[model samples]
Target chain A: MHADSTTTRKAAALAAFAGLDREPGVAKPDPILVVDNVVRRFGGLTAVDVAHLEIQRGSITALIGPNGAGKTTFFNQLTGFDSADEGSWAFNGKQLKGVPAHRVARTGMVRTFQLTKALSKLTVMENMRLGAQNQRGENFFRALVPGSWRQQEDEITERAEELLERFKLNTKRDDFAGSLSGGQRKLLEMARALMVGPELVMLDEPMAGVNPALTQSLLAHVKDLREEGMTVLFVEHDMDMVRDISDWVVVMAQGAVIAEGPPDTIMSDQRVVDAYLGAHHDAPMSAEEFEEQLQEAEAELEAEIEEKA
Target chain B: MDWNAILITTVKASIGLETVVYALAAIGVNIQFGYAGLLNFGQAAFLGVAAYGMAVTVATFHLPFWLGIAIGLAATVVLAFLLGIPTLRLRADYLAIVTIAAAEIVRLVFRSVKFSSVFGGSDGRQNFSGDFFAMNPYSPGTYGIGPISFNERVTWILTVGWVLIAICCGLVYLLMKSPWGRVLKAIREDEDAVRSLGKNVFSYKMQALVLGGLVGCLGGFLFALGQASVQPDLFSTEFTFYAYTIVILGGAARVFSPVVGAAIFWVLLVFVGNTLSEAVSAGMLPSLFTVNNIGAVRFMLVGLGLMLLLIFRPQGIFGDKREIALDAR
Candidate 1:
């Protein structure tokens, strides 16, 4: 499927997302989501305090942070899963300040949870069908008249089957979602999200609980989303996976964006290191020890990622 | 010592008036608790309010039978709204608590002496069923085969009751298979998940509450019309509990489960009671168990059977085990 023309288009999209990665809180030429002054507080603790951020259209961005950096909280605020104490944002230039979570999804900004929220009691195919947009059968009155929605339901089933096949979950279509393995649930969640044909898909820790064997495939699927000309934003902890697939990296620490750059630059940036290690800015390590610690941190991160994978 | 009489009575009880009444109530519970995962412990309130609405409308206002039916239905819808608006958004247990309390309040209000003039107080209202029986087409004659029979009045009630049951079952079957039904099941599994998928979860829940409550009101109508009287004490919390037991016995989330369950429940209850009483009369047991104690003993057996069913198969007879793993939070 990697034809010559498609490779050029992928490269073109990659180039467009380049350079802007180096600037913190930078403006994008073609932004799909723009957030300003978004803050969420729980009691006295402020969980997220994003001042300004823009996600470029048709790019794969990674939101990476330590355990308590509030990446997921920020994701929740952006997607309307939770309300912000003070904020305003837009998706494709449509103001989404007070929009509900479902409406946010309707605007082509679909999201999946860190822990997969597959309807465990529902069959795999049913879970996929639930993801489809504007289903006629979902209407209360229209649902009773089969003639009004049967054809639409059939079409939805067909689309769901196609996605199941793509996700390699076709054989398990009749099985309850709860019966699937952890990795399969994650795959099913991603596949289900695509049933909306969304322009922007935000996944929270897609590979968190996946097996290593499936993590590679999950990574490939994330890359394929961008290849299909869709914008992908994911919150992840694994540096290797982020470096492997992310076009740009946005670092968060203490609930604020500390740096934005390409994977290589972000990995080497001093602030990113301090954010991860909690090291003081004035206490620079010796060259040899610094390199060793960096390698040690990467290895430790890899082991942790593998355990979850 | 007629074993023949006992067996016949048990068979008749399986398809008797009580079965029809409980079946109607359980089917409504199926929609709320089974399909939507709603904890509607006030199902009796729906039946009570509807029954009282019909009784008060006709006996107090001296209105026509048709008008009373309309008022009964309207009252059920209003009761659903009144109960749902304050509790639907809360956790599942809150709904359970609220509904049970609401049912008790309704029963107490109806039985209170303050409304004795209008509601007939503890005696409840009678004579309102005259119009219903008048509309009955059956002539004055006994119906059915030897050993099992019904008079014209009962025959008419059975005909109407069975027809209503069929219609309600058909409606549930159609709705559960539709996309709207899919959403209800999804809400049962995870309301947040459905909401995140762009569905108005709260609205769907309210609709299910109203629909189920409305369907349950049919049982109220059948209870009053078949007995030819409406009593406040008849619609107690135990009434709702019995309906729940019927729903669970039939295997929840299945359309025909409630019907089958109600039949089996009444049959078993009557069968056990008859057999025990006969055994006691025949001197087959000790003097500690008298015939009058048979009623309580029969319920104990049913309770035991239910516990066994839950332990061995928590999903009931026809239900998928996964369906009962409710995300009630």
Candidate 2:
């Protein structure tokens, strides 16, 4: 069909993101999210063109790619912020096309943004309240009756407070969210996502700008998400963090997945190396290099805390 | 100034006609912008819609006053939904724009020559408030504890208005403390994160919009019944702007913030206005301005106060800077 370089690139991306060599028999019994042929065009640029992708039920899958590789766009499309020009997906068995972002969230698939949109003016606890907002008591009639709204309000606050505590944000409950550091915000974002008790949680760059010392804890939290029986799909640039925590890895280059497999195999793949290291494929930080950085951060943090005491 | 004069001024300013109505409207704005963070700029439309609803039902259809109120509340919710459905997911500013436009549309609709019979056009409907006064328990005689007495009719309106304010504020306080309130705060902080938790962000936003609009509708009711009239000129964009000013002045997102804000807003404006006019008449200052400048000067002073508040305490009196720190856009 004499497709241009962009289409070829998209076609290539689609092939790679679709998990190139998957045989039909190997697929899971039921997929939580099944994204097929989801192509998104922004102006003249085709940002994402995935032929097929399946998020397994109750497992952590890290959607890893370089910047501008359409990871966030893909996440937005799935969650209803952005609509797909072509393609369809579903949460559990429900087809998700034309579903509004809010409705997508209602179906038990929630997400966090790359840029933290925490209500800066509200207390940290108030932010938690927003996460637990449901429709039952939000009705006009219910709002008119104090007795009707109290129990639900109490339960939501308690749960939100508990989640904040679990995330180590309990002490800052009264503090404004804007007062928190970048890392704390990331933590708050993650904690807030647990509000609606979603079956699927999508995190956009959960560890992108976090300090190394907290990276492990963040990674642990992502792993804990799976432990808690919620499927976690996260977009990450830190390969070591992805490799260390993710059960399955999906790698994208130029808006499509180029490789999908166990971390060890994906890391060793020739194409994956070329994508990260460029055609010359040399002089990139190794896994050992990453481990050393995290270790150093951990040591320094411990020393500081010890000194404070 | 005499103690009696100040007391009268304070009472007139606090429980004054415009004060009670705007207080109800400002509380609604708090629900929309302060609580839900919807950034609604067309709250006046809710007031306008409800007023027109009442005016049409009463003056046009000759229906009972309560039925008109129901239609008005319904119309506000419908207006909110119509505005929210198209623009809620768009940038928050889009909702602001659409609402402002819708409110203007509503005002024009009420004032349009084509619908003059039903809406009473520009001059609006009057003597329509007789039904509202029929429900008043107060006799048609003045009553008071002392110098703070009110005309029988004025007392009746204020009584109803204050009760509505208390109920709305109390309801807001309880509702805001609930699970739904938590979700709204979360949406304000991070809609994406809330959505990740399987929450319906859009639906919640719509609910907030409608709820806030429903509350705003009460302002229209109070205004219509307070003056015993409904005028197209009354529901101007400035009405909503003033409500926002009240919300910000008292505090955004706090239960008592709007009520306190409404009282302060009306008082400062009236007190300053009266003081300025008296000063100009007495020639206390050089004749740089005439009595006509009092209105402009009062507005300028109020605008200056809002500016100072935004600069020094953008969160208003009760708002936390952090809660307001979320990208307002």
Candidate 3:
């Protein structure tokens, strides 16, 4: 009933990392986040089990891995989307165990999803409203009587309009979110997330489906996120983009970290190459390749049947 | 009937039990569906629950009318939270499915054999309107000239109900224009984006759900007070269905959409039904059609009309399509 393979992958990764505990309770000074013995699991599938992971303060960190390397799973666990089977993490020294997704978000550890979840029916302006903030009017009792809540409402509208203008979505404010192109939706999603002014912005994949033209804009936005004193954590497949922006990189394969360092070091690590790059783990096999392999196996079976006959 | 008589009658009928009730429910739904993007198909349950809440408190517990009102509103909020907790995080359709089922279940519980003693069984509870009528400003007489006349008690209820509608609509307008309203609209548009901004998507949803449910519950209070009665069958799925029709008919996200929709919808229903019945009875039309069949036939015609409207203009009278989305997905 649930696609929780993510949970299992994280658990296995955490266990494996625990076994390689050459490092102690030690961490780099001024770490923004520390994941200690974080284990997440699905039924019979260990997805991410990170014994120790530290996010450097105010630096852009990229978590990279093959398709099933538990990168997204780990992201889920770290951000409170999924609870760790066994682990504890902290944001700005506040323990983030058993914290629900929203509570964690309230604490400034915000995250964007891989697939965009733009509310398609609302106008771009309405979408901005949704991203605005808590107001007295949000309460039904307070929804009435404008005098008590109008000033606050005005502030939210002003803020939303400012952000929409900055993101170049001002003209489209009256347009339905569904009418926006894919890249525009991406921009809207990013801009909407910034409405809260988060300290850490965890982007699942800021450029997975982005076109070349919008790629630079997204990259610049990510840089801006860094410049604004917000930590950026993204899962990206574009090695070139990764090297260009990521201050540090952590690579994972088969639900565990294979390497962690700068993008250049991670790209060259033989373990990472064998698990992802050289083996083409990042790209799922095409339908044609799968069919060809199936045909070859069927042919071999037929030959064996003939011999038996 | 004369043309003026027909027009007057149509307005009177349209503004009666159906529109008054539906307008209230749509206001509640505006909070949920319009602002929060919660596709709650069981809005009638809020009405049903509140009706029963009032009934149970006043009739069964023998409590005062205002106390009954408090209990009803409280019960509605609790019901919204209960329904929201399990389903809010699920896909939109899941909530729809669960809410429809829940609404039916609430209706059944209100009418069930075990609880029939308190609920008055299928016969429903009457004599509950006495307290409301005690405050009626009108003496026993028809107030309006021509076909626009209303009995004293009925006139009183309409006045109160319309005032409530005005207040609710104004509230929606002001809130939606405010910052909090913007956040709700944003959540509707992009929850993940809101989530990344450190807003609690689920909490916002819960808030919207409860608030809307409470507002929807008000309709039930009005209905019970209006009729001086509470019945299980009155809270049928059609009640919620008609509310959605009103919301869509007037405009989904617009503040006054429910009011316009309720008025237009009731007017259409009354006009169509009366015209058909009169035509049939007076032998001005085919003999095959009967007054009884008018109920079913009118629905089909209305449905067809609605479908055409949706195809051509999903946004009703005053709505900008961008203001509200018809896409449940």
Could you say which candidate leads in lDDT?
1
Give per-residue CA lDDT, model 3, range A88-163, as digits (tens). Answer: 9999999999988877877888777889877677677766665544556656566556687778757877898988
Q: Work out the TM-score per prediction.
A: 0.92, 0.82, 0.84
Of 1 and 3, the candidate ranking higher by DockQ:
1
Q: Count the backbone clashes (under 3 Å) in each candidate.
A: 2, 26, 28
* TM-score, candidate 1, chain B alone: 0.96
Worst 10 residues of 3 chain A by lDDT: A16-25
Q: Give the residue spans of candidate 1 off by over 4 A.
A: A1-6, A21-23, A281-309, B321-329
TM-score of chain B of 3: 0.94
Residue pairs in clash, model 1: A210-A309, A211-A309
Runs of candidate 2 exceeding 4 Å displacement: A1-33, A55-60, A90-94, A102-110, A117-166, A169-175, A194-201, A226-231, A277-309, B1-7, B305-313, B321-329
Tens digit of per-residue lDDT, candidate 3, span B1-329: 44565677797876786688889999998788977888999999999889888887878778888888888998898998889999988878888999999999999888888888888777677766667788888899987767678899888898888888888777777767765676687777666566665566788789889878887887898898887888899998988888888888887778988887888888887787777777777777676678778788877777888888878887788877544444643
Q: Which stretches of candidate 3 lie over 4 Å from their true place?
A: A1-29, A119-178, A277-309, B1-5, B59-62, B322-329
**Model 3 misses residue B221 by how many Å?**
2.5
Top candidate, metric DockQ: 1
Local error of candidate 2 at residue A3 (angstroms): 51
The lDDT of each candidate is 0.89, 0.79, 0.79
Give the per-residue lDDT of model 1 (tens digit) for B109-199.
9999998888889999998988999988989998888878889999999999999999999999989999999999989988877866778
